[model samples]
Target: MSVNAQPCPGPQPDALVRVDEGAIWRADGKPFDPLQVAHTRHALSAHPLLQLPRLRRLALSLAGTSHVKYALPNRKAGSAFHTFSESEAKMSIASTFDHIEEAGNWVALYFLEDEPEYGALLRDTLDGMKAQIEPRDPGMHGYSLFMFIASPPTVTPFHIDRENNFNVQVMGRKHLRVWQAHDRVAVPDAAIEDYFVHDTLRSLHYHEELDARALDFDIGPGEGVYIPSTAGHYVTTEEGAWALPGGRVSVSLAMTYFTTQTARRARVHLLNAFLRDRFAAAPMPPGKSGLVDHLKQPLAKILIESRMRLYGQAAPRGMSGH
Candidate 1:
């Protein structure tokens, strides 16, 4: 299908996400909370645009672009994450896609909103969730859609992200384990601050012991889960759960956005990092002290803006380092 082709024939308003009654609720049985983990269902798994051929075309279009990343598959769940160099993959992207099932590769297409058709689909999906998201986490921005296509027996390294994510499985089945967003034991405050400051994941390490505290989900096509910002998580696609007949290639998409609360938290973390690194001050972690957090927010913003002006470095999406 062409990039502009609609999933179905005829003119109809697209509603990519489907949240049935009780589809979104916290464990405490409170009203819908965006910051908490919630299982959801979506129509994108059946969307024509996400089919392998169309995705291969998208990958070709994104070739040599920063938005596309290729990695060698990690068989061990605890292995560190790294990108594949040009020398490491001596094949064209199309060829890689052709052999993806047995190539032991993982490909990611980021910022799908920048593309024409995917952008429209992403917008519709997010718009469908506005009523549920806005009331809980207002001012959502920096919308991003990341598509991951990986071979079976591969693992996405355990790590934390800055934006709240709605991850949907498009094909195959994968085991997902997620920890709480505020679980400092899984991810330390210092590591989070370092991520915002340096854009690195070197400090975040995974240990098998963390499994005891994880909420695990084994999901297939049309199934999904909501993961709060900074939630430590990892995914593994098993060898036998391929949805298609030929190969065990797993496809998934992560739709992420930043809210007002996330923006504030980013600034606070940036400020804390500065204090710890430059001033030898051990500032309280974000959300730890209300008054102190409020006091640090503006100062952090000023610091970030000044740095941007002086260094020509744009702040992370939503102006929050995530």
Candidate 2:
């Protein structure tokens, strides 16, 4: 079967996003919503565990499990997508937010593990949302909930994520700018290869002109955006928009789904990456042949596993950031 390419018109929607006949349409008049977008953004801040005091304590307590990133807004003009400058002041995780806020900088804490206090709530929220959207088989999909706390006026930078994400804006407001996943002009093919195979940085090279092709949304408290896997996007907080009376904070949850399709795509990319990076062979486009994917997957797995084993043997005993 031969596939013909056609030029499609831009989106023209009144709502940021609209669902009709089980299809979600974007502002640009594109039928782009595949992950089933549904969000109740308002109730996020009201969650008992997300309050500043509680979250601060949680950040401090889960010291080892969490990763803190300091945003350097001035570095945006540079080639690097995100540059993190170490905090000059020695502050604890609990005090990091305050320090960042005071310095007119922003710090983001990523909580990957599900804590006992809020794990159930996160699970329930995701479960409820999943019920309203697509019918996903539990066995075929994996779930993870990441809660982020960022200071005001910080830019998260342009990047593509591996998993389908439900970006729940619980507190504060943000400008979410998303570009089409398969748009080669926005996200380069090599970047996609590096992302899947090497687990390299997901940051994309931002271009001012590409903004014209993007779908921009100003999401406030009680709103959510469905970000499909490999869709390049950047998020920046609105200054003091979501701040409470005392201080500034933007709280959000990134609920991710790793489906069977995700795995297959990863494998396909990994195989292509292996061929291109190792043998200097031109990479083939995905979804062309099932037999090719089936053959490439096991070879990719073996190569990856062998690399891991070799690296494990060569590394020093105590170093452990895998």
Candidate 3:
């Protein structure tokens, strides 16, 4: 991983490109039939429970939604929260979108995909345009062998995902500036296993890399970008200009898949957790240290399955958002 070797430098995209592009939805290229893309999206998003159908809408809602979903008890160690209020000072803003704010300004809303404004747009677009989305940018993500699940437009800043995601831009666009899982980028697992002692793995950022190339894609509405598990990246929305209707309320989706890459990342983290738990409960003896480390891989699978069971919506609430 030559990530930390020399700071790749040019002009970063975020600073240069701000306002939304003109003729945003009216993109020229046709990698996939826009109509097809919309049909697929409509079929998948027909589920009423899905908060956000169009990726862009979902991301915005995540940003704008004031109501906090209950957090799993086993969620991140720091469980600080704020009481929902229209008149309250910006309390969670600093923590909620802290990762994204490192790059630019942010605002979140709580609108479901079924909402009239967003859902109607999504349904109309899907029904009209025969759009096809490029699943994952294979150039960046040849490591995994799996199909993507969803694509969402998110102002992401230094975070990991539950599964491997190759985010594709359908109508509007957002950019992805990725960091490798090596020393140059802030490695969460190392910090978690050693200093932090947090079992649930989360992302950390080392904004040391300033190269424009490091953060690729000065993309517009109708573009696609790829990402792998443990591959760190940041996102920011570029609103449309003054005349051309709405800003780049990017229409994107999370093309999720259970890939080999995700499995590897998961396995490694699970192994680390198992080792940490074992050591914390009872320190290993000199002769048993080798045996304990060797058993970590198989033991890791057991640990991952147990944790997944804790997160289903049907399951009882384990952690509170407040």
Best by lDDT: 1
TM-score for each of the candidates: 0.86, 0.73, 0.43
Task: Compute the lDDT of residue 111 as modeled in candidate 3.
Answer: 24
TM-score of 3: 0.43
Candidate 1 weakest lDDT stretch, 10 residues: 1-10
lDDT by residue (173-271, candidate 3, tens digit) is 344555443423345455433322243333343444443325455543334444444455555454332122323234345544343333433454545
Q: Across residues 20-50, which tens digit of lDDT does each residue of candidate 2 receive?
A: 2322223233333454332223244455566
> Would you list the rank order by TM-score, best first?
1, 2, 3
Q: What is the C-alpha RMSD of each candidate to the true structure, in Å?
A: 6.3, 9.1, 13.5
Clashing pairs in 1: none
Q: Measured by C-alpha RMSD in angstroms, how accurate is candidate 1?
A: 6.3
Clashes of 1: 0
Better of 1 and 2 by lDDT: 1
Best by TM-score: 1
Give the Å error, residue 195, model 3: 13
In each prediction, how many residue pairs overlap at the backbone (N, C-alpha, C within less than 3 A)?
0, 7, 38
Give the better candidate number (1 or 3) by lDDT.
1
List residue ranges in candidate 1 displaced over 4 A.
1-31, 85-88, 242-247, 320-322
lDDT, candidate 3, equals 0.35
